[model samples]
Target: MSLAVTFAAIPYRRTGVVEMSDVGQVILCTLLLLAIAVAALVVLKRKGWLARWLGGSAILDQAPAIKRIAQTRLSRSTVVHLIEVTGRRMVVVESKSHIRMLPQDDMESHDPNL
Candidate 1:
């Protein structure tokens, strides 16, 4: 048995620096990938796959518990919504600090224009 060991040093040369076009290309590629990922995620979420992954109990056989009928912004931090649950329609006032039910007749029959 014979073993031969040989080593040769390779020469190195530096190239030109990265151009603005290169940076723009990288940024555009990154944004395109991100947009694709976001679109895919939206599709998955709408189809309830993401909900199943998150253990949200949303299944094909069952319908959603609450349905939003209408919504109005009361202020910057407050909102009023009309929602349907089971078979009842109700108005709900929601703020950052509290959530409470409102009278539908009072909200609808009482007009601010008067």
Candidate 2:
């Protein structure tokens, strides 16, 4: 047979172009896999199996080191908070752009004014 006839006799193969249906199927499968993984994590977390596997206490069980005792807003964008952290009480001033803490001496001086 001639080269043209031989080549023509071979089966036609489509190359390079991807169909929308094939893309949709791949996306669907990826979403299904992710959903299953998330569900498994949720179940394990509820059962505390993940904590045991990681060999430590779950982070949520520990008591917080910093606690907010009181807070007051000076204006719409500025706030003052009385907070306790690591057994030390302090005043924290927060604005939209900055945060600052008063010293212990300042706390003593300001205690009676509040």
Candidate 3:
């Protein structure tokens, strides 16, 4: 039996400096501005001034439109059954042609009798 040893050569290359186009610079600037705007908005939101200017209660009420649609659509197609185990844990079974399990920890917690 003969044993052979093989050696591989490593490859390296020098990289040239990159020159960005006007569009690339504009995009980078736009992204920076967007980040700053988001930070400002977050600060304003934390201070409650954003809510005051935007009519926060109205916005919150309107935010449920999509959720209401989803719930209505799902309820029409799926049959929902609830089972309470104890304390703040409940199992919600949604069955259509198939059975699906859902945990209702928050729901049970909010229930007055729970």
Output the number of the lDDT-best candidate.
2
lDDT of 1: 0.85
lDDT for predicted candidate 3 compared with the true structure: 0.61
Candidate 3: regions farther than 4 A off? 1-20, 57-114
- The count of backbone overlaps in candidate 2 is 0
lDDT of 2 at 60: 56
lDDT of 2 by residue, 1-114 (tens): 556643447767776476877998889999999999999999999998889788757665777889999999999999999999888888899999999999667867675856
Q: Which stretches of candidate 2 lie over 4 Å from their true place?
A: 1-37, 55-61, 111-114
Clashing pairs in 3: none
**lDDT tens digits, residue span 32-110, model 3:** 9999999999999898788978878577545332121122224666655554444333444465677764556555557
- Best of the two (1, 2) by TM-score: 2
Listed per model in order, the count of residue pairs whose N, CA or C atoms clash below 3 Å is: 0, 0, 0
Write the number of the candidate with greater lDDT, choosing between 2 and 3: 2
TM-score of each: 0.40, 0.54, 0.32
Per-residue error for 86 in candidate 3, Å, reads 28
Cα lDDT listed for each candidate: 0.85, 0.86, 0.61
Order of candidate numbers by lDDT, starting with the best: 2, 1, 3
Clashing pairs in 1: none
